[model samples]
Each structure stands twice: as structure tokens, then as C-alpha cells.
Target: MPPSDLDLLLRLRLVVARVGESDNANWWASDGVLSPTGQYAYDRIAPRTGPFARARVAFAVAQERCASQVPPGALTLWTLPADTEEAFDDRWSHWLDHVEDWAPTFAAVEAINTSSILTALVEHGLIDGQHADAARALTAAPPDPSVRLAETAHIDVDAVRQLAAGFACSQPAALVVPYVRSNA
Candidate 1:
């Protein structure tokens, strides 16, 4: 394929999973809602609260990073601290707007790297794949949290190597490139 075509094929995907604060302690009491047999009570997640439940609540709270791209690019999924529902919508919207502003265009992939986006996504709850190619594809399989970093990031390798000496990732090399941990 022509270089222009390859650049045109770039894809930008963002899948973020932010940890939110919880107030529904009794959510599992089965009193909120129950199944047909009443044996299993829904965990009452953001997805569970669809129109049938009540409303669309913000999910994956923390900081949305980028996921993947079609032609193997990068994405930016901005995640924010999801605490209360009072101003959730506003915060979510603002953060999303920010990400949108910083989002990379396929046309600019050559100028700006896409690895950082994928790393951010992985830091959040975007796609989690084993291979570098898969990671750049927005695969649904999210990788483990608290990884050293990605070589794609073009970060200091020795820093990650040092971190790996202490806190290493759980996933095998089959999933992704081994990241070394850093003391910092």
C-alpha cells in the first residue's frame, strides 16, 4: 500500500475504565433489584443502570486514555475521578472535551506517536491485548493494571527496567511487551 494509504488507514480507539467511588454498600443485598430466581442480585454497575434501571451513569471513572487505531494508530481516552453523581455529567463532559481537543488525527500519526495513547488506555480500562499489534487494535481484552510502560512510548528504558525489578506485571509476554517498573 502507498504511504498515503497507510496514513489514511490510521485508527483511533479509546476504551477507559475508571474506578469510581461507591456509596451503594447494600447494592448486593438483592433489595435494590433481583433476578428471576432472586438468588443473584445485580452488582449495580454503571452499565446495569440502563433506561430500564434509571439513567445513564458515568462509567469507568478515573481518567480516560486512548485505545487503538484502525491502521494501528493511537487514541486518547481521558479518565477523571468519578466520585459523586451530582456533577458527574459536567465533569465527564468537560474531560471528554479535553480529550477531544488533544485527540490525534490519522493525518498526524507520523508527526506524533500513538504509543502513549495506548499506554494511557492500558493504564485506564481500555483494550488489553498481548501483542503490540493487538494493543493497537482496541481489543476488548484489557490488560492488567499498573504496568511499567510501553517501548512504544519511547520512554527511558532503564527506568522501567528498574521498576520491573520490584513491581512486575502479571500477564505473560504473550499478551504484551514486558514492562519494567521504575522506582519513581
Candidate 2:
């Protein structure tokens, strides 16, 4: 039997999330501007818990997953607090709520965000400008990804240099189009 389309789609999303998360963690670590764990984005969400203590833990977990070349083992440890069992819900988000109310969502929505972030990294030179090869390894792009991988995956990779280029232009920002639910 063969796996369904949904399975393939999910696998792609997983790859994207892992790569993106890894990049974000690395970026946060050596940006040279942060005072340990201080991220300007999260300040509005919550107060600091004695500086780098909390932020270090978060990046460590993310980087550990990257180092293993797979999702981290035993995320179940990301559970609710209270020194009791019933205080928790069996979901990642719930566990995060226990840890910090803001939680820093990076679920499947990450799939949509990865392309732009990678593009940014390439543009900013955080990662090597060998962006095209990295993109090819991660995607089965059109004009036959397998053949492209064979012919140009390793060279100067100029042909596929436009890697994931379409996505940045085609995918729109996540917009919340308002809808009126009828009052009558």
C-alpha cells in the first residue's frame, strides 16, 4: 500500500518547520544584540523570568532537536506545572500555557512562515548564500526535482538559484479577512 497525499504533505511541512526553527534559534543565539534572552517581540507577551534563564531553555530545546537531525525526544517533558498531574492538558500548547501564557506558537502555521524566513536568512547572509542547494535538498521543485537534484544540486547551483523563489512571491501573508456573522 502507498501513503496518502496528506502524509506526503505533512512530511514536507515537518521538514520546513525543523529547518526554520533551527535557523531562528541560531539567529537568536548570536545576534550580538540580545541581552541573553531578551527578544523584543515577546516583551509585550510576558515579563522576563530573571533574564536569559527562560529564553536559554527554549532555544536549547529547539537547537537540540536540530542537532539530532530529528524532532527532540521526550517533548512530553514540556508539561504543565503545579507539581501535580491533573493541572495539565495532554497537548503541546496546553503544556506551554502552563510554562508561559504566551506560548510562542509554531505549530503547522510554521509551514507557511518558513519560506519567507529562509529567504530572509539568505538575504541577510546568516546562512551561506548557497541557498539554492539547501532549498533543493529540502524541496522537490518543478521541472523534475529528482533530475534537477542530479544535474545541478551540487555545482555552483546557479540554475536552481531561484530556489523557493516562487513561494515568497506566491504565498500571501497570513491575513485575517473579516467576516460578518449575521445578527438577525
Candidate 3:
């Protein structure tokens, strides 16, 4: 049988955890935007396992399932950017060239906040309120620079594991990736 949407999400969380471990940084720091190291790790693993594709499928399924409760676009607030630097550069240049034209698009994107998404997810019985609360706390901005720095150094792997497991089952099978540490 094909894996369920929850299963794909769990696998994706595992990939994120592994990438974060490799970079010595919190994957949630960028609010779903993978850092360079994280991107490298994802790219390295994607071809072998297709986690991203599976994640996209899962996301699509969720969006369809929650269409009435949540706006489809809201589910993709942190969609990954294209893989090529040149594509990014071109897109950036275009945006820079037509900043005024893109203002409304930017505004619309910004209006879809994390809280609403989490609320919808919780209401739909997709995630527990505790998970949503934990996510909100993790993403909250600390006032102190020292505290922020300290927080960044620690990646909450257990929280992610718990969230994933909660979504899937009481005891989900582990995803095994042959991660080889490199000194390069």
C-alpha cells in the first residue's frame, strides 16, 4: 500500500531533522526556508528517496481535504524555492525591477499568517493544540540577542519527532537514511 499523507509528513520531518543535525542549526529557524547547508542535504537525499515529491503529494492531499476550512494557498506558505541560483537571481531581479507590481502579491502572501494555518489544522483534527502551541513558541522571536543565539544552537528534534508520530500513529516506524558524515 502507498504511504498515507501523514506518513509522508513524518518522513519529511525526519529528513528535516537529519539536515538540521548536519548543519548544527535549528531547521525551524528560517520558518521553513532551508539554509544553504539544509538545502544541500535535501538535494543530496531527494534523488535517492524523493522525500520532497512525497511531501508535495501529502501537502496536496491535505489541501484538498481541508479546502473548506483552510485556503489552499495558506498551506503552501513556506513552499521551497527552485533549485537553481540562476533562477532565483532572475526572479529576484524581476521582483526588484517591478517592486510596485509585486506589492499586492507580497501583501497577500504576508496576510496568511502561521496562526491561522495552525488554527485550521487544529480545528480539522490534523494536529493537536499542544503541537500548534509548541510550534508557535518555537517560532516566537526572543527579545534578547543572547537568548536568540542560544536558542538557535539547539534543534528540538524530539518535538518534531513527537509531532510526526502524533500525526501518524502511536508508534510509527522509523525512516532509515544512510547518512554518511563528511569532513569536506
Candidate 4:
């Protein structure tokens, strides 16, 4: 039997998480400088070359193969556009040039946020109702102050809430409007 859409999504999540963990560990070890040893290590495992590359390519193939079976909005929640591959490569190159300044770009963060994926899966009856409620609750919460700081240290609480609202509004899938924090 073919793998279910849920299985594909779970595999994709695991793959993406592994990539993130590897990137984080490498960043900490090299301090984003990529010295000779670091360069060698990266060359062996970078997204374009070795295990990571193979895993990504396999996952992409699986995703494409299973696309027709996935429910509407499910694929969109988990998959990025084809052009994002080039953009991701560009971002990695930029990171190499700007050592010690590594951080997830806004688009990267948004794309990786799993709330929408979880919600969509639940709506499609792929995940349990309990998870659906949890996903909705998570998306409904106000943006973390630290997230705002990452984007701009000068943004106030109100501005953060406004931005979050705007972001939620822009998404094609249903996203709950974040409630205003009481202290704000």
C-alpha cells in the first residue's frame, strides 16, 4: 500500500527538524565562521552534497509523488515553492559571508512554523481533535516578545500584535487572530 498523507507529512517534519538541528549544532561549533576543519565537515554534510542532500532529494520526490493524495491546503501548509530552494541556497551563502550573525530569516521562520500544518492536518481528519485544539490555541497566542526583538528591537507590544494580526490575515489558510496580552 502507498504511504498515507499523514506519513508523508510526518516524514517531512522529521527531515526538516533534522536539518534544523544539524544547522544549529554546526553554527554553535563553528561560530558561523567555517574554518578549514569546519569547511571540511560542512562539505561532507551540507544540503547540496551528502546525507542531507540525499535525504532532502528523497523527501522532495516523495512529496511530489504523494501530492495528488494530499487534501487541499495540506501540501501548502508544509511545502514551500520551488524557488525557495534557490533562495535557501542564497541565504546559506550569505550566512557564510556574515559570520557569527546567523539567525532564521523571517520567511524561514514563517515557513517552518508547524501550527498551520498541524491545524490543516487536523481539519483534514488526519490528526486528532485534541491536536487541533492545541494548534489553534498556539496560533491564537500573542507573538513572543523575543520574536519581535529579533525582527526589530524597537517594536512595541501594540506594534507586535498588529503585525501578528496582519501576518495571520495574509495567510491563505485559516489562522486565529492572536489575542492581545492583558498586560499590554
Candidate 5:
């Protein structure tokens, strides 16, 4: 059976989030300096060789889906707190609440986020050795996912690039509507 349209939307959103977070180019793009195609726009300026072929394809599909469906806006980043106990606790609680809300409709994304946070905790040495092991052991299974992955059609790379180029244009600080293209 084919995936539903909503499934495609969710997957595309997830991919956009991942690529946006990973690449600084996407960060700037989200700031409206370029198209919200994230890594696709970044690769346009600075190409790199990689074993990330599959991931790249996934991101491109996500970018295209988003360009077609979701409107561009401000960029939001998920961050781990500083090493301070208060900060850590606050951040953790905030994320826990977010996951609880997300789990009901986006269990796969929630699971991915949970795993990412756990890995960050261990990697940053916030929890070490036995504590890390214990945390890992006590991890709960992700709730039933509302969406599943399926193959998507390939997006036209050149068209996305052209759109990104248009997005990179900017106006003077006080100007609105008519954009004076920045010499980037």
C-alpha cells in the first residue's frame, strides 16, 4: 500500500529539521538569507563528497516537499542546556513536556528526539559510565508511530536551486516588499 499524504508531510518535516540543524548554511537560510531548502542550498555554495548519498536524497525530497507545501518562517533550533544543573534540569523538563505532546501524534519523531537527547547526555559527560548505562537500559519504547516511511519521488534539483537563489535576495534594513538582492 502507498503512504498517505500526511505521512509524506511528517517525514518531510523531520528531514528538513535534521538537515537544517546540521548545516550552518541552512541556519542562515532559515534566517531568510536563502531558501529553506536547508542542506540543498548549502551544497549549492559548497559541494562536498560523502557516503551520505542516501541521506542527501532524503533531505532533497524533504526540501522539495516543504517548498511545495510548508511556508517558510523563522528558524528554530533544539539545544541541550549548559552543564549547570539548573539549566540541565530546566531543559530536560521542557523537552520531556514537548515529547509527551509530540508522542501522541509524532511518535517516530519523539523517539528520534529522545534517542538524540540521551546520546547527547552521554557524549557531553553529563551522565557517565554506570549512570549512562543505566539511563540507556531504562529507556522506554517509543509509542506507536502515527506515520510510517515510504519511497518518495525525486525532486528537481535545479528548480530548487533556482528558488533558493531567489530567496537569497534581500532588501535594505528598513525596506519592505521590493528586495535589493544582496551581493552574496
Candidate 6:
């Protein structure tokens, strides 16, 4: 059976949470919520502006995806750090308004992940055989978080190689090409 949208997002979150693991391995919890470490990592990556900028972009996409799917007002309702429900609602709505500013960043994340990580997963044997079609389908554009997930989620090969390259000079820089295929 195909994976559910939440399943795919869960997988994506897992893969991304491990990025730069010497510093970010435990960035997220199993439930996909951001831990303190995750929040720090997000803060670190969010301001980056250069090559390999997907770290922060990914966080925004994942955050937005997660927030958009849950029951309306649930985050504010249950996550109130405020003394009053009214205050909680007001703060949460303000946060949502702030999140809207991340739309462009989220779009960039979708583009890079579709072009880079999605293809890299296949090239590195993280995706293969029957699952390739579903992975390929994702390259067209960022699907709704409600997209039917592939049974097997793709791997984060870029992180693997970066770890390897830390130990071996022979690791090729070209291993993780960030190019988008014209047909994708």
C-alpha cells in the first residue's frame, strides 16, 4: 500500500533532522515536533544564504506542512504558554501570520529537494525499482502535504557522503549534484 501524506512528511522530517549530524542528529523528536536542538538547528540554518541552503528551507516547508494539516487552531489551543485562552489565540495567530512570510523559502525548499535530494536518493540507491515512479512524480512540483506517500521513503544520501567526505579525500564533490532535470 502507498504511504499516507503524513507518512511522507514524517519520513522527510526524519531525513532532514539528521543533516549535519555532528551538530543536528537529534534535531526533531519521533513525533515530528521540534526539540530544543531542532529549534537551534532551525535558527542556525534559517539565516544561511548560499549554496546548500536547503537545511533551513526544509524546516520551513516541514513546519508549514505540519501546521497546515492539523485541526484548525489546534496548535494554539493545546500549546498555550499563556495564562489566558484569548492571549493564547492571539499569540498563535500572530505566529501563523509570521509563518506566512516563509512561503518563498518553502518554495525554494521544494525546488531543491525535488531537483537535488529526490534524484540523489535514486542515484545513491535509496530509491529503486517499484518506488521510482512515485519519487519521480514528486519532482514535478511540491505536492500537497496530502499526497499519497511512497511506501518507501528516500534516503538522505547527501548527508551520508558529507560524513564520508569528512574521513576520505576520495569522496567526490560531484556526488550530490543539485541540478534540476529539464524534464523534471
The candidate with the higher TM-score, 3 or 5, is 3
lDDT of each: 0.24, 0.29, 0.31, 0.31, 0.28, 0.30
Candidate 6 error regions (>4 Å): 1-61, 69-117, 137-145, 150-184
Ranking of models by lDDT: 4, 3, 6, 2, 5, 1
Model 2 lDDT on a 0 to 1 scale? 0.29
Candidate 4 lDDT over 118-154, as tens digits, reads 4333333344555334333443233321111022323
Q: What are the per-residue Cα lDDT tens digits for candidate 6 across 88-171?
A: 334434334455554443333223222133343344343444444433443212222222222212222332222212111111
* 1 versus 5: better lDDT goes to: 5
| 44-150: candidate 1 lDDT, tens digit per residue | 33232221121122122212211111111221122111221223344434434443432333112212222243443344322244423433332222443333233
Which residue pairs collide in model 3, if any? none
TM-score of each: 0.18, 0.25, 0.23, 0.25, 0.19, 0.24
Clash totals, every prediction: 28, 0, 0, 0, 0, 0
Q: Model 2: per-residue lDDT, tens digit, 1-184? A: 0123222222222222333342342322322112222344444444443222333344345334323321222111111122211322223233344444323322222222343545543543333556434543444333321211222222111322232221222122221111111112
Tens digit per residue, CA lDDT, model 5, 147-176: 111112322222111222222121112101
Worst 10 residues of 3 by lDDT: 144-153
Q: Which stretches of candidate 2 lie over 4 Å from their true place?
A: 1-55, 64-115, 139-184
TM-score of 5: 0.19
* Candidate 4 wrong stretches, greater than 4 Å: 1-48, 71-78, 82-85, 92-184
Give the total clashing residue pairs for model 5.
0
Please report the TM-score between candidate 6 and the true structure.
Answer: 0.24
